[model samples]
Target: MASFFAALMNSLDIALLLFIIAIGLNIVFGVLHVINFAHGAIYMLGAYAGYSCMAMLGLPFWLALIVAPVPVVLLAIVIERLVLSRIYDRDVADSLLLTFALMLILNESIRMVWGTGIYVIDPPAMLQGTVTLFGNVTYPKYSMFVIVMGMLVLAGLWWMFNRTRVGHIIRAAAIDREMSQLVCINTRFVITAVFAFGAWLAAVGGVVAAPMRAIDPGMGDKIIIESFIIVVIGGLGNFTGTLLGAIILGLIHGFGSRYFPEVNLLLPFIGMALVLLFKPYGLMGSGGR
Candidate 1:
């Protein structure tokens, strides 16, 4: 029972982290109808930016956590304007190819700039220790922080989409771009904003993950596949579906790594395949954008 509980906690943590990382990809797809292949690159850049803030700029971890995503958010905005915008009217394949190219460019660019070596970041001082649960069971404080932050992010995103005017505009634009344009909704602006916001969320995940994982140029490539699975298994462009998909994948990872070590890496993909075979759209997904 205790072991099950531990696995549950670990799975939940992984689920939350995956949610934070993949939510942006869904959002961009939801609004822009463009699946961003470079989302992971932006996430990788965020971790590197956090490292830079702490290592080179002499910023504190907390400050770095807050500020590290800014540049990446801006980069997303620029990418949307300079690259994605031009292809908005083209076929979906166009955006995918462009984003794939962008991802490749970012991977090499980051390697050229930050070197091909892997880097790690230390967790904030306040999150350095462990918290005991009951009868010798303890949990890492940083892991707890990740879970809490993920909940907060979930709540914040809910409020942003449900309660805010911008959220309403986003939904409207997403539901009907041509009609939204006719109704005077700046769909162009909304698409750019959503893309940038999604980038911001991805970077935030990267910053949070810096302390937990080794930061490297290859990090994005590894995560992109997982993110794709999460998005697909949850239903492309479906917010709630993404959450459920992340949790399912997280559970698969946690238990599979422990009990089926050799197959751990393949579990999520297997789950993805099952979802595709059974539901095609995902457990919570209705369809693509």
Candidate 2:
């Protein structure tokens, strides 16, 4: 029973982090029809930025978390204006190719900037150790924070899309770019804003996960595939679907690592394949816009 509780707690953080990382990808896809292959690289950069702020500049962990994502958000805006903007009207394949190229460029650049060694990020002093729970089970406070942060983001997104006027415009533009523009919506602005916002979410995930995971140059490469699988299984543009898919993947990881360690790495892929086979549009996808 203790083991079961431990696994469940473990999956919560995994599910939350995956949701944050992949939700941005889904948003970008939903708004721009652009598959951002470089998103994981952006995530890696965000983590690196947080590490540098804390380790090199002597910033507080809390401050670093707040500041780490700004540069990446700026970078995303520039990428949209300079590279991604060009492919918006072309074949979707163009966006894919451009993003893939950007990913390679970012991977090499990150190595150049941070070298190849694995870096460590210590959790805040207050969260440095485990906290005791019922039945004397101990859980990491940082993981709990991650889960709370994810919940906050989920609520924020819900409010943004369902209650805000800007969200209405975003949704309208996403549904029909031409029609939205006819109604005087600034789709260009919305597209750029949404892309930048998506980048911010990815950066938040990276910054949050840095203290929990070993930071390495190959981290982005490792996560990119998982992000793609999450996006696919969740549906191309469905936020709620992303949540469900993230939870499912987290459970797969938790259980597979515990009982089927031999096939641990393959479980997520298997689940993704199964989802694709039975529900090609995903749990809540509406096909294409």
Candidate 3:
């Protein structure tokens, strides 16, 4: 039972982090109708930036969190303007292929810049220890912090999309870009902003993940596949679906490897396949936009 509880805690943090990253992917798709295959690479860049801030520049983790995503976000903006913007009207395959190429470029660039070594970031000093819960189960403080941060982001996003003017504008534009422009909404700016925001979210996820996972170039490649699975299972462009999917996958990751070791690696893919086969629109997705 204690082990079960511990695994639950572990799954929560993992799920929330995945949710944070996957939601960004969903948001970009929801708004721009673009599949950003390079998102994980951007995430990798953010982690590297955080590492530079803390390890090399001697900045604290909090400051690194703030500073790390800047370059990634800027790069996202540049991509949107110089490359992605031009291909908006093209088929989805175009975005997929282009972003795939961009991912390759970014991965090689990271290798060139950071080398092919694994790096670890220590959790902030305040969060370095462990906390005990009921039945004497202990959990890492940093993981709890991650859970809190995820909840805050989830709340913030809900409020932004439901109660704020900017959120409304973004949604309106998503629903009808031409109509948004017809109403003087400056949809071009909104589109770019959404893409940048998605990149920002991905970068934030990278920064948060740095302390938990080993920082390496290949990390992005692994996460991109997971994020795709998450978004696909949850249904593209469905925020609620993304959250559910993250939690489900997180549970699979947390328990499958522990209890079902022989088939652990295959569980998530199996679940994804089942969802795809039975509910092509995803669990939370209704047919059509």
Candidate 4:
């Protein structure tokens, strides 16, 4: 029972980190109707930024957290204006191909700057230990921090989307760009903002994940695939669906890694295949966007 509880905690930690990243992908898709293939690269950028701040510049983790996502967010804005905007009305495949190119470019840029080395970030002093639970189970303090942060982010998103004017404007833009423009809403700005916001979320996930995983140029590649699985399992552009899918995947990662180590790498793919076969639109998805 203690081992089960420990596994559950581990799963929750992994699930929440995924939720933080995949939600951004969903938001961009929901509002802009574009599947950002470069999101993982942007996320990798964030982790590298954090590493630069803490390891290179000797900045504290909290300060690095604030500073790390700035460049990625700015780059996202540029990508939206200079590249994505031109292709917004184009077919979905166009966006995918273009963003895939962007991802390759970003990956190469990272290699050029940071070299092809794997790096690790040490957690801040406060989060550099372990905590005991259930009288016997132990978990990393940083993992707990990640879980709490994820919940807080989820609450904040709910409030923003449900109660704020900006949120309403974003939703309105997503629903009908023409009608929103008719109402004098600067939908262009909203679209840019949505894309940047999604980038921000992905970058933040990168920073948060730095301490938990090895930082490398290829990290983004792995995450992009997992994020796609998450959104697909939960249903693209569905907030509730994204959360549920993250939790489900987390569970698979936690238990599968422990009891079925040999096939662990294939578990998520299998789950995704099952969902795709039975529910083409995703577990919580409807027929169309």
**Pairs of residues at least 3 apart in sequence or in different chains that clash in candidate 1:** none
Q: Tell me which of candidates 1 and 4 scores higher on TM-score.
A: 4
Residue 153's lDDT within candidate 1 is 94
Candidate 3 collision pairs:
none
Q: Where does candidate 3 have its weakest 10-residue lDDT segment?
A: 280-289
Candidate 3 or 4, higher lDDT?
A: 4
lDDT of 2 at 57: 94
What is the lDDT of every predicted structure here? 0.90, 0.90, 0.93, 0.95
lDDT of 2 by residue, 29-91 (tens): 999999899999999999999999999999998999899999999999999999898888898
* lDDT for each residue of candidate 4 in 1-289, tens digit (9 for 90 to 100): 8889988999999999999999999999998999999999999999999999999999999999999999999999999999999988899999899999999999999999999999999999999999999999988999999999999999999999999999899889988999999999999999999999999999999999999999988999999999999999999999899999999999999999888899999999999999999999899898687
The candidates, ranked best first by TM-score, are 4, 3, 2, 1
Q: Give the candidate number with the greatest lDDT.
A: 4
Looking at model 1, report the run of 10 residues with the lowest lDDT sum.
Answer: 1-10
| Shift of residue 289 alpha carbon in model 2, Å | 5.0
As a TM-score, model 1 comes out at: 0.97
Give candidate 4's whole-model lDDT: 0.95
Return the TM-score for each candidate structure. 0.97, 0.97, 0.98, 0.99
- TM-score of predicted structure 3: 0.98
Tally clashing residue pairs in candidate 1.
Answer: 0
What value of lDDT does candidate 1 attain over all alpha carbons? Answer: 0.90
For model 2 the TM-score comes to 0.97
Per-residue alpha-carbon lDDT of model 1 for 13-61, expressed as tens digits? 8999999999999999888888899999999999999999998998998
